[model samples]
Target chain A: MSAEVVPLPARAPSLGPILSLTQTSMNAVNQIILDRMQSEIPLIPALAGHLIAGGGKRMRPMLTLAGAAVCGYQGTRHHRLAAAVEFIHTSTLLHDDVVDGSETRRGQSTANIVFGNPAAVLVGDFLFARAFELMVEDGSLRVLKILSSASAIIAQGEVDQLVAQRRIETSEDRYLHIIGSKTAALFAAASRIAAVVAETGDAEEQALDDYGRNLGIAFQLVDDAIDYDSTAAEMGKDKGDDFREGKMTLPVILAYARGSDEERQFWRDAIAGFRTEDEDLAHAVTLIRRHDAIDATRERARHFAERACDALSIFPESKARAAMIDAARFAVSRGY
Target chain B: MSAEVVPLPARAPSLGPILSLTQTSMNAVNQIILDRMQSEIPLIPALAGHLIAGGGKRMRPMLTLAGAAVCGYQGTRHHRLAAAVEFIHTSTLLHDDVVDGSETRRGQSTANIVFGNPAAVLVGDFLFARAFELMVEDGSLRVLKILSSASAIIAQGEVDQLVAQRRIETSEDRYLHIIGSKTAALFAAASRIAAVVAETGDAEEQALDDYGRNLGIAFQLVDDAIDYDSTAAEMGKDKGDDFREGKMTLPVILAYARGSDEERQFWRDAIAGFRTEDEDLAHAVTLIRRHDAIDATRERARHFAERACDALSIFPESKARAAMIDAARFAVSRGY
Candidate 1:
């Protein structure tokens, strides 16, 4: 927990525009984040600080801030709410490192590695509780309801993913459902909360939620594809991490569905058998490319990005609206 | 996640009196629990069900139910709140087992051992979400605030415990604070929330919280003492679990303080060094008895029990009131 978070690779240029657009609210959100993360226990702030410093781009929180700006929210409540969103996200990252036994995340040693699993798990719970505290202080039962349910759904999605961990036969529908709940639900909540704070009508709220949701799905799809894309090293993770861990991502599922009998057997042997030969990663890559799995996955991302853009059609000509649309493009653009 | 929970030992007798007193609402709370735990992802329910089946006293939830009754409330909202209390307790227990790497609880397999650590951790999170869902449905900002703060404090206490884990130099004040936050905070929240539900005045609410806080401290003190007592097996867990784990409970602190120089060194080696000699437990028990540490610990519990009873004096004479007082007695009665 005492470990300092290593800074990320600059700001990942793709995120710069949207971040620059929402810079004011994002800065406010960051201040609140820094405030809520403090604790008398040095380890808590240390561990939380480590993750915060690891450079998440604060994407979900940025969504909250940006969504509020786009919805014309004038109050300071969104700052606290945005902080809550980041706390929840960071909390899950801590627990996820424990659950996944992951040692590295965001190109830095995960908190579980630096602080130990027990510290990670407990601090994660602390952050979660802090998130609830923030929302409760906000004094909106509706907002509380939205964020709390999203928290539950995100957990359910993680559990669902664990249920699918090594099973090559996990359905594509199940994959979509997992990503939607685990990733997109929070995004939707982040966006919708802005509307709630702004006292906007349901239509506008739903539009923002749709934009966030579709963007979230696209974001995760692009993330999954990047692991298999030729430039995975540029993504700051070792290529074939999902494969070595027997993670049944979209590309692996697609490749399995489209591969020939021998290739299917190869995947079964490599994935189910937990084989991590250097050539195995290469062969898996070869088969995925041959089956055009990465292309198809990115295509799915593009579709969702389009949907995200479509959800913004109701917004007036405004900088906030345009940046959100560009944010969708940024999500899909990372798939190389 | 797919594993069915093994049934618990026929219910422990200690909880019987409180259980009988709060029978009706407890039953209603149970129904809500069963209903809310249902999830399409069978794994969520499966892991959660494992912990639920492990036969906890459900004391915290029962406090919520009973506290509401003692406050002269007749509404059904307490049922959901009580269930939320249970969910929070169960969720922490799930994560606790993983953090402790414990294999058994309640004379049955712990959820982590039965469902796997990842499943236990994720399902624990799901239950937390479900608990929040239950509270949000109740729609009380005060309840949300109380419970959420308690949750955060509990996590802080756990981390403090982890930090204090092999250190014999941990002060008695630190130990009490740790236990107060980790164990008693939820109890206080559970009790205080019932008042919120009943719309009781702040004085009544504070009294109930005091009652629960004192009772909870008493409860944990007795439970810790029982581990080193000869009757630990009757308590359903192995004797010396805490001692082996180097937990700095009250008795241990007292024994360390009162021991001779040689005996103090023994304590240091056995606890700080994680060295468990075959005779160490027996010798420690002998010293604890010679120092009257267990008796002193029980005395402390009794003091708290009396304080708890005093807190309930504001209420009128009634069955609920009597039972509340009796519950305090029961908490301290488990020790020698």
Candidate 2:
């Protein structure tokens, strides 16, 4: 995943205001994360900490914290909930890195690379279990139902992605559905559970769910864009890593749809052929740029970002509300 | 895992009575398993079904069902909980196959082998989430707490086993701890939660927990012994697979502790060095036999079996209670 959204110089700032707004709650979340990640087996904490501490803006948990804050929640339970959200996200990352055979994450070697696939897979399971444990402690069936269902959907999304891997015929709709479950389900649950915790009514819960769902889609669209447009350093991944893996991101889908017939063959040869040329990545980038796929993807991200902001319109204006809007913007703009 | 216990022709039957007694509840649990395992992604259930459908004795869920019956529960909540218990067991099997690099389970191709590691791991996560979902639907915080915590402990046990993989110094106490958390904890939780659902008091809960815990440990010990003594057909895995994987099962531990210096070197070279001599498995089996590790392991299993039966002493002599006592005896005696 692209770690953060890169804002244009003209924008006030991305994630900064949101981070500071949720700082106290975020600190508690971090503490819970540290305490919960540890096990009698050192490898769990070691593998988990490597990814969690490598730290790409803890945006999901931030959404949860901000959601609770925006709803005028005064209790400390959101901290535990936020930490649980982060654990779910981190667990997925560990498994994703293994599935993707990724070597780098957050500009460092991936956990699967440092530890083994077995360790990564088992530790991921441990973290997921710990997330549920936290939710159980929170003592709300609704919250548990939401998060657990999100986890199931997330797994489905990952499997769907696996099925779609290297297939040139993968459609934009399919791509959105995959991301909707894989990425946005957790995001939606993270935001929606905050309202549940705050005992806010269904309307507020639905609003926050929409906000997080749209924000997550926007975040992923920009992440897809960053994969093609940014260098290895900016993406915290090898350049054209998506192209290498034959992952059907939006830019690829858009370019494949809009490109000349010859360009379609190039994508097929480069990705689905199972023998990526050394120039395949660079060639893929050129075609993506030539068709303005990156720009189109970013525009779609902007659309979702707007929707995310609109979802929060029901809440009264406050620092939390304003920061949440910036977070939506940040989701689209992070360091691209 | 030892897929099933094959009974000797001369001995009293194992698992048969328990299965017959809980036939109705088992059928309900089985139906739920089929229903809940279904998913839109198809791969989730497909991979899960590949393992779940591979057909082992559904012993864990059987414990949950029998636990409820022994308590004279009339409600259907135990069916859901029993399904949850099976899901937890099935989820671990998926992950465990990947971790063990196992090629066969219950005498069939392992899910990881058939579906690939990525599918195996993600599907495992999906099943686990479904388990939590079932517990949430049951709408009891106590049930949720027990199962989730068991999950965490199981993960820890797997990691601890990973740590002990090739370490000859791995103690019996440490090994027992690993099995306690990884295997018996779930059994304990499964049985105790039945009491929770039945609204049985703490005394009954504790009794059932002890019964299940001891039975689980006893089950695992027999499983370990079976790995050494049983044919590939009997064990449903390659003979000496644990030794091949460098797993510190009880027989290996006993043999290593009791062996000659030459035998120790052989184990070190074969296991820790990660090179299998052509006859390594044969040599290992011979050494295990020479040390009487199989009988010794069976003896220990019998000890746990007695404890399991003793824990059920509080309950009156009913068919359910009698069947449960036989299960403990069956746990140690099947094909030994």
Candidate 3:
């Protein structure tokens, strides 16, 4: 059967005001990252330029800028902080592609595929180092402490996912733990750094940090859900690619737990056995749908989105704060 | 002619003192590392324990301790600093093995090979994160600054080596540049941190920093030299493994440059063509040896060693300082 391709909506719900606010905040951060990424090593500068120019969603950086703005940060260091956040994210992507042996990302050839694994790995390291250098320039040991911890958490999450792949008993808690480490840790760090940078303490800092973490969790859950719901064309990669790589994301984890004995056996064979036949793909998708794993996963995402929005209650009502809440909602509602 | 297996001498001129000193320093550092590598995550503690307990050469950590001692550091933080240094090195090895797709390290199956790549990668990150956490406890921005920078340089070096692997004209300058970033940067950083932790200023700091850098370069030169000299049995891997991987270490780079046009053509085909047969290995080795690549490489190693010893002149002559000097010389001459 031919799969239906769902185009990303040109207009996200009420995105006009939100985009303008996000863009204004993000522009300052983006400019700083570009400027600071310069290096004497030709390759370092070249690769940095390529990555900065690559047009990532800038989700984490935007979160950082928005978080600081909501807390009334008038200082310029937020821009540097945001850029450091993006560099960390980008560096991870470079290394991630190498680890996964992936050849493409976001419909473009992966850096590893284009630049080769070693270039991707080393360049990733360059970005990471550059990020630290940028952070040090800000001279906030508190900020440094937060970011270093976040980086470690992010690495741990990726490692957890690596070890847990294709294991039948991977629980929802395990899934949450992995996603929290890999994805939410950085998001939380980015926003928290904004708070630390701005010297906004107590309830406001905690609120903003919670907001970032929840939003990140919601974002990743949505991503995992989409992997199951979307096709190769819609997702810009093959359907069940995660399964092919022996990854058991949220939907699969849920389905495996809820499926019949035969269905459970199928997952064991299909994922663990490395079965890539079309029949296996069709069957796996059917089982996921039959188990209503998609809806269940979406509910989890919405829960996190709501929690993210609720975290903004401590912030005095402002356009920037409101936009952040909207973005959290929009993250869950985007591909619906 | 049957190849003669030249055993590492039981009592080489410098090995006895060097080994004894390194052993003493390493034992202290190892104790500190073991005591501190704890975490809330049971997996983290377990995995870290496994890795630290796996008995690496601890060359990098020893460098940090020796650097501190030679610089006349009496502080206890050097122990943590040494452990931090080792953790970073160990973490990199875990990731490096995964990236290189190798299965053995230090004459044992690699963490990636034994535990699988995901575990190895994540555990490596765990160690990295743990290192930062440990460093933060020291409350020395100088150490953090040096370490963070070293981390970045090391990653960049790995990337540079990745790109440099297949290119035939990868210059000696480029080789040094890559090694400096990848290997020597950490060595330099480890020693520099030791100096900082000791509160040594200016000349002494620069001396130890230079000592670390030169020693690292010498160490790598010996490593590259040995890649051509050792075998699968002796090295615990195949001879020409680097050649097989299309890596152009110093010997191959020199041989290719110095060989006859026909010999150069042979190398070009062997490297570029992905040739990995026994005959290809034999020819590559023969060409490299016939061209005096080994001798030339050894000379380069000696130069760096001499430079390392020269860097120690700033310090008052002492047993610890003498040992460090001997270690530099031993880095070059021990195997030869």
lDDT to native, each model: 0.87, 0.88, 0.79
TM-score for chain A, candidates 1 onward in order? 0.94, 0.95, 0.92
TM-scores for all candidates: the values are: 0.95, 0.95, 0.89
Cα lDDT tens digits for candidate 1, B58-100? 8898898889888899889999999999999998988988898
Task: Please provide, for model 3 over A191-221, each residue's C-alpha lDDT reduced to its tens digit, 9 standing for 90 to 100.
Answer: 8887887787867778878998998899999
Off by over 4 Å in 2: A1-13, A231-233, B1-11, B230-233
Comparing candidate 1 with candidate 2, which one achieves the higher TM-score? Answer: 2
lDDT of 3: 0.79
CAPRI quality of model 1: medium
- Tens digit of per-residue lDDT, candidate 3, span B1-336: 999999987754364555676576677778877776665455665666666787666777777777777777776788787888998888787767777878666566766676766566567766777787778777788888888888987877786777676778888888999888888988888888878888888777788889889989988887888888753126544456688778878998999999899998888888785678888888888898899898899899899989989989988888778888887888888456
Question: Which DockQ value does candidate 3 get?
Answer: 0.40
What is the model-wide C-alpha lDDT for candidate 2?
0.88
The sequence of per-residue lDDT tens digits that candidate 1 reaches over residues A1-336 is 699988876543266667887888788888888898888888999999999977777889888878887887788899899899999999888888899888778777888989999999999999999999999998999999999999999998998888888888887888999999999999999999999999988998999899889999999988889888875547545566788888888999999999999999988887785678888888998999999999999999899999988998887878888788878887887745
DockQ value for model 1: 0.70
Candidate 3 regions exceeding 4 Å error are A1-15, A36-52, A230-233, A236-238, A273-275, B1-25, B35-52, B230-233, B236-238
Worst 10 residues of 2 chain A by lDDT: A230-239
Name the better of 1 and 2 by lDDT. Answer: 2
Q: What is the TM-score of chain A in candidate 3?
A: 0.92
How much does candidate 1 score in TM-score? 0.95
Lowest lDDT block of 10, candidate 2 chain B: B230-239
User: Which candidate gets the maximum TM-score versus the true structure?
Assistant: 2
lDDT at residue A25 of model 3 (Cα atoms): 65
